[model samples]
Target: MKLANVQQPIRLGAMTLPNRIIMGSMHVGLEKLPNGVERLADFYAERASGGAGLIVTGGAAVLPEGGMGEVYCNVFLDEHIEQLRIITEKVHQQKGKIALQLFHAGRYAYKEVTGLDPVAPSPLQAPINRTQPRELDEAGIERTIAAFASGAVRAQKAGFDAVEIMGSEGYLINQFLSPVTNQRQDEWGGDFGRRTRFGVEVAKRVREAVGRDFPVLFRMSGLDLIPDSTTIEETLQFARMLEEAGVDALNIGIGWHESKVPTISMMVPRGAYVWVAQQVKEAVHIPVIASNRINDIRHAEEILQAGRCDLVSLARPFLADPQIVAKSVQGRFDEVNTCIACNQACLDHIFDGKVASCLVNPMVGREVEWALAQATVRKKVAVVGAGPAGLEAARVLAERGHEVVLFEKQERIGGQLNYARQVPGKAEFNETLRYYQTQLVKLGVEVRLGTEASADELVREGFAEVVIATGVVPRRPEIAGQEMPHVVMYNEVFEHKVKVASKVVIVGAGGIACDLSHLLVHDEVISPEAAEYLLAYRILDAKALHKLQTGKRKVFMLRRGKHVGTGLGKTTRWATLAYLKQNGVEMLTEIEYKRIAEEGVYITRNGEEQVIPADTVIIAAGATPNDALYHALAGRIPVHLIGGAKEAGELDAKRAILEGAQVGRAI
Candidate 1:
């Protein structure tokens, strides 16, 4: 808990950091909001005050064709320098060092957004962007190298303490490094040395523009995570080349945007890719930074102490809790709101071209508007149901100097989240519960567990306002033989109230069903120790390793819709479904449910009647809102409805917490 390793100061060129945790770059979609610059400044300022040693900003395009749209900051513009200065000044005021990331999307850039054909090292079409980019000609390549140097100068002019060349994550520079994208016989491609020239030249030009004294970092892809990409030896060679080019440090990024691997998701184990950084660290003389899914201070300290890398970079963790480093250093690690990496609000929002926020912390983008202020009038408030909604409402109200009492019928908090934590890979949900438990106590919230408040009692208590966050109940599906002993709800399986057999047939293919299938199939959790031993000993290859990870079970999910895992986040849905498929979970869409018997589930798929044999049947057909308390208390004292009591279409925790905060502030 002392965090000595992370607390140790590290130097990069002329700059010295107070700690090893860097707030990694994240495109928060805050640059395009109304009063965007000020909001962006406030966003970074809060994180800086919390205690990040260095903050690397989101990508700032060096060329007009390199940008995504109006959302991106074009450093070539004169106006952008003044706006960027505001961000640098705010972070400096908090005693934090900030770095600007010079970026070019290349083939990753969308023609729809930039209104121009994307350019790349070759004419290879990018799978993710679905765009066939125009190959950069000789003149275009010269201009690009010059543009990177100009961007670095602009960043220094804007008062940034450092400048990081964005060369990773399948960007313009990465495209030139990988053989998968680069196939030209010219000087820019056809060999490892030729391919690496573009990135090395960019780094050299940037260093020359900013001088040797100014800090310069290059974010390089340690593992492209794609087939026929850069090998480990090639990556190490690139790192050495970058050091020779006067780059101060190396930030190792894993995978690419077009990679099939799930780099940053809830399913990925914490600190999963630090080994990649360790390889780069061993190859380079300058400091190396490990990134991707390194969310906690303990993980960061361990990575540094293990000599994996010189520093750790955390992007989503800061979004989840701006004060993550501050709280951890104070020995309140349990109170830190850990990033679950659900991608529901952060990456998904970016992909959809909307302002990004956090599922756990909704006030991320709305910093100025949602800042907690003392309430004008303090009064007794009752928030029923100790789920995410009630817990958040109680915490916010108490923080605003209001007396709050929270009620829960169950003996514990986290209503549906309790079931969520039971699923493999979602154990991080327990952290959310732990954070609320600590905050509720610190804020002096009166939590009444095992005591469900009735509408009559709420009126009798003379509560100024009653929040009905009663949550939801499972909606039983209409099927024949529904009362069979083998049939049970999703929560029953999660709670171990009903035993799950080998062959399981689940009714519904929503997020819950997908998660249930995953839970049932994975009989035993794969510990990181076991995974490392298996790989380190060379006992199993990649294919065999994947087999061992997914346990032996037969799961069949039936749905009337075409797509499985509907309503899931864009960044997560595909990976979840792919993992399920790899685990042998059969998903049948556009199937009409016939009946559930002792034998199995009979369904009509493509007008063919067939019975899916199963030992257990699970009903994960979503839920209906539990709003009886709200109706009972209507017009009886001041009453309000939130969370599942208000709506239960998809059990959206993001909306629930947001509504709870808004309602708490309203009172």
Candidate 2:
């Protein structure tokens, strides 16, 4: 657990980092804020002080047309340099090395935000962008290469220690490299040599502009994960070309933005794409950095020890806990809040037009606003729930110098989260529980498990204030014969309180119902060890391995609404639905539930009534607030209601934890 390999100092070009762990780039939407410059500076400064060996900033557009919406920073603009310089100065003050990523969105640029036509090597339209792009002409290509060089020069002026050319993830450089996006017969496309020219020329120009001794990293797509795209051999060859073009190191990026592959999802195993980086490292003399799902020091150390890559880059993990390195170095692994890759708060938020934040660590993007200052007066408080909200509130309150006690009626903590961890591919929820457990104990919060505190009991126990986070309960929908012998709730299914049938029908197509359907179908859960063993020995390919983890049974999910995954985040909804679809789970929408019968459930679809045959039926409609205790303690003592106890519209852990932290700061 010493993480000796991760702690080893490594050199990227002329820069010697303190350790091998690199904080990768993440576009947090902070650059577009009114006080963006100052806010961004504080955000990076915190991570720098938290002991990041080196930090690669969010992508900055090298040119105006290449901008990824208005949310991204344009380093090519001279007006932005002074603001960016503040960030570099603050990070330098923390004694941490920082790199600016020069980016061009190509066809990925948003016409709605930038009000300009996107330009790529070919006029092919991006699936996500949904707009036809103008193919870059000969003159435009030269201008782009020059823009990359100028971006690097501007980064140096901004005082960045290094520059990372964003060549991966379906960006401009990647668009030119892949045949899927580049079909032109010009000098920059149609063949492998032409496809690779743009990236190499950009790298050579950036190196020339920055001069020798200035660190330059190229983020190359190790695996496009898209069919008929760049082959693995071509990817490695491109890496060699980049090194020859004077890139100090190669940072391997897995999957394109258009790829359906689950690269950074919870289902993706830790270090899943390390082999791709290993291939690039073998092909190049320069150092290589592995990204995608490398979430912790242990996994990073393991990869480094195995000589897979020279260094590892973690983006979302840094957002989950800025002090991931510092805490691990101090041997406080449990204290490190691990990124669950839920995408609920971070990526999903950005997609929802909100700034990026973490689900577990709510204070990520709000470093300036939500500072955890010490309390002026210490008081004893009682948190009457051990779910995410209560756990976070208890941890923060104790950290703010309060004597806190966390109560739970159940034997264990993590209220609804306990059931969430039981769902297929959601095992990372257990890590969130582990972190809260560690933090609560570390901050001296007394936990009373298997005991529910009443109003009089809390008042009599000398508690100055009470936080009611009693959580939620499964809402039973009004359906005839729903209480039949074969009928059970979703929680019962998770707790194994009832036997599940093979041909099952699930009522309500919310997040829980989708999860239950996923659980029931995927009976053959492949362990990570078994998967790695199968792949390492070439016993099975990735496609074959995925088949083994899919449905072993039949499931049908019916909802009254037209949309499936109604409450799920945008980042994960499509993928989850796709998984269910692959498992042969039938998701029916715009249906009316009549009743549950012995044979099956009767439903009306398109004004036609029919019975869906099933041996078992489950109601995962939704949940309602469990606020009986909150009502009882309302006027008797000072009380604050939070989480499901306050509102059960959606079981949102992001809002729950944020509320907990806010209340913790308030008290």
> What is the TM-score of candidate 1?
0.97
- Candidate 1 yields a Cα-based lDDT of 0.91
Best by lDDT: 1
lDDT of 2 at 630: 85
Q: Which stretches of candidate 1 lie over 4 Å from their true place?
A: 525-550
TM-scores of all models? Answer: 0.97, 0.97
Model 1 clash pairs? none
Residues 272-376, candidate 2, lDDT per residue (tens digit)?
A: 899999998899898999998878798888899999999999999999999999999998898899999999999898877789889999898789788888899
The sequence of per-residue lDDT tens digits that candidate 1 reaches over residues 148-211 is 9998999999999999999999999999999999998899999999999999999999999999
- Separately for all candidates shown, the number of backbone clashes (residues 3 or more apart, or on different chains) is 0, 0
